[model samples]
Target: MVSKQAGVDYTETFSPVVKMTTIRTLISIVVKQGWKIYQLDVNNAFLHGDLHEEVYMDAPQGLAVASSRLVCKLKKSLYGLKQASRQWYDKLTEALHSRGFEHSVEDYSLFYKKSANSSVYVAVYVDDIVLTGTNLVEINNLKSFLHDTFKIKDLGQLHYFLGFELLYREDGVLISQRKFTTELLKEFECLSYTAVTAPLECNLKLQAAEGPLTDPTHYRKLVGKLNFLTHTRMDIAYSVQHLSQFMQDPREPHLKATIHVLRYLKNDPILGIFISNVPDFNLRAYCDSDWAACPDTRKSVSGYIVMLGDSPISWKSKKQATVSLSSAEAEYRSIRMVVGELIWLRRILIEFNVPCDTLTHVYCDSQAAVHIARNPVFHERTKHIEVDCHFVRNSLQDGSITLPCFHY
Candidate 1:
């Protein structure tokens, strides 16, 4: 639909997607505050938005009027238009702003308002909205107001949103993606495949040398879908990242390894990240890198996970863009990326009034990487690294990041 309305020639078609980290963070905050979260879905969400560009659409076959000579010109947004999402966001933001909600500067989709007596928060991802507040009466009032303005369908308590199953329990809320995982396994025909302990073998090195896949498109699609699953399943992030490197020319061996990941999932499709009511909100991050792991380019892979108390909220595994001379260099580069995320997360948490302790703790398995972060003296061995890697050392000296030794 977007292709028809927005020409294929349009540039900058990408839009920011709400990260799973942001969603989990919002849920954690609501759980901590003992607030009720209500979900709402806007029926025909795209139709509610107004389009700015002059777009013409062919009239429906049977509904076309005989006197109508011109094509239907869109006044409101449609699903396929390139600007549809942005327009919907603008419309929603305008409505919410008029209703006394303040948008988060860091994340535009997040809005909040607090008074002496009541507090309310709203987060929008395209059309899906999760509303939370301290007072039940105020939440319902806001819902009614939104219904009046946008005619929203109240989904009551959120059972599922963006593939994460949300179950409200008396003890706390439980979030998982069991159904999504089960479907993925079945779709890949890995239901009967034997299970494996790890998503990828430590020694398994995938190269682009193997012959081309019989169905290269299918392999690409599978990798793309699994990429989304990684948001909730950090175990597969490294494997997915590894497999994705060959999307341009995926080989049979790469496809086999990708299927191997599915076989592992077949064992327990319900395996998902569980965020419970943990009191400790201390920020601790663990970063690791496999030196020269990629077979084709010999680039290292960086993997890291950040946990709030006991629950793991964010993790990533990606190949380094540059070739590192040593494991310490690779680990230091990974630390730099992880620290960047931590800084942004800390800033967002502060805006939400979450108490993030003064110091952010970053854990590295490599003591040499720790030394690199702490020491100002760049030895001949470390002199070749880019200037950005030195930022970690500066941050440590400025007391912005606290690097402590941690075991995976």
Candidate 2:
């Protein structure tokens, strides 16, 4: 008799997931410049890769097996095999490389190709691919090539991708997850609750080990789903991140906090980040921190927002890995994190051949943190953050970044 199991943690074998920031940034550029964006789905994407190992599976119930003795050997990667994604990735990357696309060092899942006057970009997330470029004929040509090889389903335009719904207008594109959020609220029976103004109460503080234990399964499920919503709903990111920290030993209070987030979504499920068509797509960032916010370990929470022109493209809210002794220290750490994001995004734009003549602007509410970044006077208080200190100072000296004394 043949032996087989359904699945294993495929993540252990392959890690090809694209960063959400890359997706958001790409879409932002597409809409901002009024360029073509298309979606492609590879039909039975995993089946195209040939299997490496000799895996035997039991004959199907309807199969005419002779004496139940014939076990089928896998010739190609199947849908549920642990190595299916990896095999498919290797096959696809080889195909892309043969066609002259260079794999991006900043993001492995992103590939780009450029000619004297034309450029094309491809972002892959498993079986789904989003493509954009300056040349329409080249885009269609590439589509035909991929379709001929992989038998892809060419989903037109980019109205809906992954879990995001794109609503296009004359001035901008609105990205939302109203359908997904509605289903989530209904699934958890939170749709009937009255809407709230905010995802979290200002006084709310989540601790890892406090509060009575609840259904661990339900808490983990709710928290995981909420984390997905954060991709388009940045307002709920801080609260969702807070709830996620307690997934291991979730308490009733954590569940309540998640419910609060659902309630906030109910307030305006259709609302999302707007990518405007404004031509001046300059980059700017805002960073802040809450010193010693966590009651359990007194670790601070760091949050930042990165904007392309006026619309937000990337953001993060999470507890800092280390505890800071002062508010200025916490803010300094937050600055370093956001600055790193800025540098990466700038590099990506450069790769895409986008122009950037003006210096990137960064703003922080803490005057003390800003003062420390602009000057090199290292006293006892500043010695610990010397690495971050020099990081920002060098950028400043190079004229790539600036901390405007009074931000415009």
The best candidate by TM-score is 2
Clashes of each: 3, 0
Off by over 4 Å in 1: 1-16, 64-69, 116-118, 169-171
Model 2 ranges off by over 4 Å = 1-12, 64-70, 386-389, 406-408
lDDT of 2 by residue, 191-236 (tens): 7899999999889877776678746899889889989989999988
Q: TM-scores for all candidates?
A: 0.92, 0.93
- Which candidate's lDDT is highest? 2
Q: Give all candidates' CA lDDT scores.
A: 0.81, 0.85
Model 1 TM-score, all chains together: 0.92
Work out how many backbone clashes candidate 1 has. 3
TM-score of 2: 0.93
